[model samples]
Target: MDISTVEDALVTDAKAHLIQPWPTSGQIGAEARSGLMDGDGIYVTDMEGRRLIDGPAGMWCTNVGHRCEPIARTLYDQAMALSYSSPWYTMSEPSVRLSKRLAGHAPGDLEHVFYTTGGSSAVETALRFMQFSNNVTGRAEKKLIIARQGAYHGSTYLSASLNGRPRDHDWMDSASDLVVKLTCPNPFRRPSDMTEPEFCDFLIGELRDVIETRGAENIGAFVAEPIMASGGVIVPPQAYLKRMRALCQENDILFIADEVVTAFGRLGHVFASKEVFDIEPDIITFAKGVTSGYFPLGGAMISSKLLERLRSSNHSDAMFAHGLTYSSHPIGCAVALTNLDLLEQGLLAHAQEIAPYFQSQLKTLEDLPLVGEVRGLGLMACVECVADRKSNNPLALDLEVGKRIDAHCQRLGLLVRPLIHMCVMSPPLTITRPQIDDLVSILRQGIKLTMDELVREGLWRG
Candidate 1:
């Protein structure tokens, strides 16, 4: 049978059996879907054998690239040795070693580790820990979580409630009263008249107001991503994180740094909280690139200070009571250990060297009329489409500008993530300068193609 015939069969089976996440039913089989067959380095091959450069790195997780032999071998060897162990009572060698290694790399005196299955679980664990700590210390009312608009924490019941993205909570029911939201510190989305410094001050002042009104004793934690990845790669001002940390310190609120996307070399570091952002978070939640998308593994790093307090406090006898069956899976830990080695060996340095070039090249897209903004930090970036450059008004949602760009980019031998009216890119850290050039060229053409289509449809003028 021809490859085309095989691809058709697979797509048919997928349409019937697969239920995709975050899309309407009509979008399922509306377009020709590419079934990824394999990945090598920065490229992935579809069922039809088309090799395309992976732009978003499998949801911003594949930092060390694809089909890494060491990672694969580690997974295989660990499975052969010990696949699973009940994390409730028993412990595994790999898990212990990984915890020690991660704690060493983590910021501050965060010396304790609680393993989870993935990013959501890591976040869930952190929030649960905060609640438990508060309850044990006789501060049951201090359970309110403070999350920011445009933040993506996770999808679990408690963690999802902390999500501030509109679409994430529009249809879904959340523990709303339990989570209070602060303004998203997106400089690009800030009011036009406000200067960057003024915008920062405004956001900081708003947090202070929330603390004063809501009462800092009532708030449990303030969760934030150093660079808001899923929220169109919104990078805040340099001093924003430091200032927030101070506020948390002053209020006795636990500061949870959701470094799921920024950690493990995506930002050219093992952990970005202290190394890049210069903040000491009480708890740090991490996942995604921890295993470089090779295995499902995530964890929370607890500060020694907090743990000591919890131990010395009356809640020392209170059971925290939270554990996933796969919390400390040996196979996942083995793969993550190897993944960390790969990052430290060379990929981290490579990412640090090439990130500025990547950001600069993507920024060049701003010259295009359809591009309202091109913003990024390190390997992550986003191109926000706009109907009017002067007003920076976003293009109509019905236009599906990001999807249009994705289609053109796919045709041009590249893959990008479409987030509403924006296209996000965070390719494998191992991507070369030449590959970045190719990626940018395709994006340029894709934007042009999208613009032409919108103009032809009378939906936009460019």
Candidate 2:
């Protein structure tokens, strides 16, 4: 290998060879994203050697922070011991150990685990298991999945179909008929005439109406993220999740809580569905922070009651017929176990302690005229820029406002996750109070700079 040539042409080669996720048509295979060279704690050094606060925490996965020694050591040690294991034929000790640990942390009767490669695979597994269970129990017609607007499940075909973001389906194909999308529960975007409580009522009534019209027997599951992450961190109204869970129970619709971004210490807990919202779901899909982005690992923690029902069914011999080659990779499982250890050993408590400070400091940004609203829960938050404060409309402004803010923030030593006109912040759980102050300060300056730029360009009047 020509080391010098590769090193000199890294960005050029990436432009020529890489197909980055969510690429635009104009630069699908040629976009050169910001190159990160190194990471330590909640900070990452860019290719230019500028250290920046990891504002989005590596897409909301680096819970315990970057370069965590125990997780890194576990990855190396596990690979040295036993790198691969055929999950179908034999399971590794780490996988079994991780399963027991996860089951212990999981809420209610969610005592069984089905490992997957990542969030998409976890969601796909849960849906497939739902279908498989329905088929075995003699209800083949029960296959519809209920999702919500502004929700993001995953990238796999079936999982992607459940994504409610319009752009996700703009140019791509999906099994749209198999999924039903309800209205987004963002109070900021709710109808102008409806109060917050009324908005909540409307959402619940809509779900009830859908169940009645579509028939609960035909609906297999209702999947939701406790707090919508990728959809600009849209946290629903109070008691919304619990009420939805109750509805799912009454209608016999399996509740699949997609905790891909909310689990594993993100919300200061191993799982957020029960602790944060006081509802125990029938199935919970998790990934991301489980291994703190050190290794790709995810799984669906299924209810034991559901498993028992399937076991007692007449066609119990039928197979689920789904799995991944890396279903229970020894290295991934080992890494997850160590990552959990870090969380259990006070990292989770630290997150709980610092989240309030993080949120309050970010809330101060609302004083900026360009900020439409600041909303989120726990360590995840979104700063939405609107065209006008009174109307709170983002459509009238430049759609690339987020990107502009991100460009300014990066120059000021912070990397933001720009989502259209919104900027999402989910720094690593390992971040301290001073680090949170720095993050908010950088973000505030970034927005102010963006506002000035817009004014100079005749884009806005600040």
Candidate 3:
């Protein structure tokens, strides 16, 4: 069969049998989506033969770009040597070596690592550890987790409960009783009457109020992402994370930094908690870019101070009793080690140097009448669309504004991740200045096209 025929067959099969993530009720199992055939560096080619820039970097995970030779070779070599090992009885050398390397890069007292299959499991493991630690230390009642609005932790029960994004928990049941949520620190979405500093102060004050109302003794952990990635790249105000960390410290609550989207050179660092955000978290959960999306590997780095305290506690003999069968898979660890090498060899510095240019170029999109704001940090950014500049209301234009823009951008040689009224761009670190120019140019045209459509349809006037 020809390539087009094969692509059609694949799509038919998927529509018949596959149920994708976040499927709507109208097309839960029968959704027909785009068919991507191949990827190289910062671009992917669809089955239709259109080469498009990978704006979301494969769900913000492909840090070193697609088809990396070193990571590919490591996968093969490690599989040939030792493909898998049961974490229950045997531990692999790759796991041990990678753990040491990661520990060296992690900040402060985060000296130990617990491996998992992916981000959800990694976050689940961290929450379970927090619960286990409290149980063992005779503080079982302190099990309520603190999460913020617009945050995305994971899909597991405990972790999903911590997710505060819209529609995350609408159709699904969660451990709602075990979680306390705070306001999202998005400056753009803050009340019109408040200043940025005042908004920051309000967020901190709200957290303090929650702690006082619920009693800090009942709070087990405060989980957050330095910049809420899936929530439209919401970068909190300056000093926000540091202040939150201090509050967690004062209250004896564990601060969990979910860096699944930010770690491994996405933000020009191995870890962003200390180096970029100036905060040391008690537990750091990461997965996406650990192997640059080449292998399924995620882990939670634990604070040495917390571990030492647990070791000295009276219930030290109590077992945590949590382990995944593929926790330390040899192939995943080996690929991750090689991926780290690539990042350290200069990709990290490259991301740091090019980040300013990326942000500045994307910021130019705010000149469009439909664009309400252009905001992000590092290599990640979002172009939020609104009906009018004064009102800054995206709902007036409808949530599908992002989808319309994405459709236009895809036609113009780009793939954008549409999140309601926002289009997120987190291209691979290997993207050059020229590639960025192309991306921004295509995006501007796309938005302009979308604006024209809206105006013609009488949905918007600008």
Assess every candidate by TM-score: 0.97, 0.98, 0.99
**Tens digit of per-residue lDDT, candidate 3, span 367-440:** 89999999999999999998888988884655689999999999999999999999999999999999999999
Where model 1 places Cα greater than 4 Å from the true spot, the runs are 25-33
Candidate with the greatest TM-score versus the true structure: 3
Off by over 4 Å in 3: none
- The residue pairs found clashing in candidate 2 are none
Pick out the ten consecutive residues of candidate 1 with the lowest summed lDDT: 24-33
Per-residue lDDT tens digits for candidate 1, residues 185-296, read 9998889899999999998999999999999989999999999999889999869999999998999999999999999988889999999999989999999999988888
lDDT of 2: 0.93
lDDT of each: 0.91, 0.93, 0.93
